[model samples]
Target: MDPTLFSSIDFYQLAKREKNAQKRIRLLALAHVKEGKPRDEIAESLKVSRSSVNNWVRRFRCDGLEGIGNKQRSGRPVYLQPQQEELLRNFIESHKLSSDLPPLKGKDIHAFLKHYFDIDYDISHVYRLLKKLKITL
Candidate 1:
């Protein structure tokens, strides 16, 4: 597990633009590891946990160049399909056009998704999904 394996054009570009101290330190640790420095030496020089060094090395092994970058994973992916998303959007749009529905509420949409999709997601997640769909509410 050497940083040489992680070094690529994209990795250099990321290293140049990267500003966070923790991320920079992580990258530097990988660089040292690629240069054949022992983990204990790298940890001492970077003033970080040896475990952190091992974790980043493992990530490099698994993801290659992109592994050095932070990933956006949080929870499991939502099970909804694209059609389901479209259906939700159509439902919201129809409600808006007819004015038959009450004012849009986060709780309202959450309940709707629960009943129709049988999946529970937070109102905040719904809000972000709506924003991504360019739906203003």
Candidate 2:
């Protein structure tokens, strides 16, 4: 097992020095991998796959810094009905609720919209919709 450092800094320093989140994470993971960290440790530390470590190393070797960033993810388009999603946004803006409760969870808001506006939504879908609106949870 090699103990070479992949970048100028240690893993922690590489993580802090890199600007892009994905790139920083990958560099830190690469530093760990080069230091011969266990696959599970690398995966858990980086929240990526053991296979992803292999993939990252390949990308690093092939493309250098450019490939350390996120790849575009491909999947079925996830959607929330635009009109209903907007309605939820508007309702939250309009209504000021005071309760001995945490800020309304997405599920609670989803249920509220469904019950009052006859809008159907999965709770997770509501979270995605909120993200599109750039509303922080």
Candidate 3:
């Protein structure tokens, strides 16, 4: 790869200011690249693989510093559709208002899901859903 660096940004200053460790390393790598360091040397000195260094450099070439930061991952898909989620949220609210019972636990929510929606979520995922929906406890 050609020794390429963006002239517009001061990567060393960015590296010094960066709080995230991985981002700091990426900025350091860019600073090295700006000083004409070899990819192998950047990788070795940065304790990352040469392929990783090359990937960062390629990203930098394409989109400057913003490209080298972590890309947002498409995490696991939602189990329920938006309408279904709205239904669930509304159900919980009405249930809470009408009933004198304590806050619903994960298993109660699990039972509701299985009985109403015919969806069987893992217990952990039931809690995750609760957290995602901002349903307290």
lDDT of 1 by residue, 12-131 (tens): 345567887667777778778766799999999989889989998888798875676776778976667999989989988888887666777888888989999997888898888788
lDDT rank order: 3, 1, 2
lDDT of 3 by residue, 50-136 (tens): 999889878988887788888899998777988988888987888788767777778888998999889999999988887888987
> Candidate 1: worst 10 consecutive residues by lDDT?
3-12
In Å, residue 28's CA in model 3 sits off its true spot by 0.8
**Candidate 2 C-alpha lDDT tens digits along 51-128:** 988888888777765667787889866445677667767767655454554676788778886787776777887787
Model 2, residue 129: displacement in angstroms?
18
Ranking by TM-score: 3, 1, 2
**Candidate RMSDs in order:** 4.8, 9.2, 3.1
Misplaced by over 4 Å in model 1 are 1-23, 30-38, 51-75
Best by lDDT: 3
* Candidate 1: pairs in clash: 3-34
- lDDT at 118, model 1: 96
lDDT of 2 at 129: 71
TM-score of candidate 2 relative to the true fold: 0.42
TM-score of each: 0.62, 0.42, 0.81
Positional deviation of 94 in candidate 1, in angstroms?
0.6
Candidate 1 lDDT at 91 equals: 84
* lDDT score, candidate 3: 0.85
Off by over 4 Å in 2: 1-12, 71-137
